[model samples]
Target: MTTVRAGGRLRPPDTRGAHRDAPLPAPPVSRRRGLSSSRVAGWGFLAPVVAYLCAFYLYPLYRNVDLSVRHYTVRSFVQGGAEFTGWDNFRQVLQDPSFGTALRNTMVFTLVSIVFQYAFGLALAVFFHRGFRLAPTLRALFLIPWLLPLIVSASTWSWMLNSESGVVNYALHLVGVGRVDWLTSPSWALTSVIIANIWIGIPFNLVILHSGLQNIPAELYEAAALDGANGRQQFWRITFPLLRPVSAITLLLGLIYTLKVFDLIWITTKGGPGDSSTTLATWSYRLGFGSLLPEFGRGAAVGNLLILIALAFGLVYVRVQRRQTT
Candidate 1:
């Protein structure tokens, strides 16, 4: 027998286990080192995103604000030492004759586009949620408008709505209605752009609203049906109430998007017919780049107004959401 240490007490070693000695376990890994390495890796992944936002978003916004405050001529824009006029640029923008027209058009275009887009989108989403035959295929087809490039869509509308040889006039002629000058006449130019914008926007609403509908439990509808609720009643009581959050967000997004719609209006009518179709967006572009003499300061001021409008609506949304949650 040989002495062995057991719990700090002397004991004789077992004869059967005397030939084998258990080795001590390896030391545990250092948690502090592992955590520090993981933190470094996380920062490495985040650096690119932070840099991109600073470069593209924050830097441009700062420059725009700077441009708005300073009276910069083409020479001064390229060179340095532009005069800082403070709110004079904004005042000029507000006092200009075209400002009223642009403001009115902006309001009409934004409100009309958002209302029709939401209405049509919500209708389509509800219809498609029924899951009828070929519904999936039809829903995908509706997304074509949203998927196409904005330029292509605008150009297509221009061709279709051409006064001389367009399909729309031809179709109207078949029904004995005279051809209406869509893009040219001041009276109809804004209306024409609004129609095109409405068409382009509906699909976005449909996709978002449909996703919201999917999250609603089907049992609620079944329960309503079992309670002798009619289709309209069920929709009003169950569907609409549940879809309120989605509708709010959809409308907010639509409002923001429609407010800055420049491409379609520009490509189709170039905001033409003597500022009839000109919105704040087109007006800003026209001031900055559309004309021979660019008013960079005034243009930046108008652009800032648009930004402020969007920001106001965004704040309202956040407040409303907070209230709902609380």
Candidate 2:
């Protein structure tokens, strides 16, 4: 027998169990060194990725910030010199009359696109979630728009929405409606781009919302059914409440993406019909590269503004998400 003492209490241990009761010896020095070496090797494996991010993302971000406050130009880009200008770049960006229009168009385009995309996408998600025959095939086919390159989609829509000879106008003519200028008309150009973006965006919504809907247990529906709840009631009482998190994240992401949309608008309208379709993205490009003077500084300022807006939205999204999870 042996004495064991801990926490101000004492007990007896059997001599036969001495080996099992003994504290294990520390590992050999080489084994301890091996653990530290393995840790170093693990970090070594991540070195390349860290280096890549620093070289690309972090460096570009730093350059963007630097450019935003300086008088950068085509000449400066070629000669590697730019003069420091305090808030003049931001002042010009804010003072530009067209900037106001671009801001409004960006707002309208982002809001309308998200609303329609969410509406149609959620509807399709629910419709397909019921699992009818050929549903998978049809869902796959619906993703064709999303699978197509943005350039391809934008060009196709441009052709389809052409003012005079387009399929959309032709269809409208058959209904006794006169020709509608889609891309060329200032009043309708923003609307046309928004419509195209909405169509392109719906597939994303459907896929995400569909996955969320699938995660909800079928047993809940069955129990609700036994309770004599109708279809509409079950949807609002069961499905809608369960889908809030998915919907919030999807809408926020869509808003951020839509706010930065340039390719679709550029390819279709070129933000044209005299700035009618100009968004912050296209406007920023026009400032930096498309202008005669090439106000790279102003463009950087706008880009930074866009980044700040995205960050604000992201913060709100994070807060909402955390509240939901908690």
Quote the positional error of residue 33 for candidate 2 in Å: 3.1
Task: Please provide, for model 2 over 133-223, each residue's C-alpha lDDT reduced to its tens digit, 9 standing for 90 to 100.
Answer: 9999999999999999999999999999998779999999999999999999998999999999999999999999999999999999999
lDDT of 1 by residue, 145-232 (tens): 9999999999999999999989999999999999899999999999999999999999999999999999999999999999999999
- Clashes per prediction? 0, 0
Name model 2 segments beyond 4 Å from true.
1-31
Estimate TM-scores for all models. 0.88, 0.89
Q: Lowest summed-lDDT stretch of 10 residues in model 2? A: 11-20
Residue pairs in candidate 2 whose N, alpha carbon or C atoms collide under 3 angstroms: none
| Overall local distance difference test of candidate 1 | 0.95
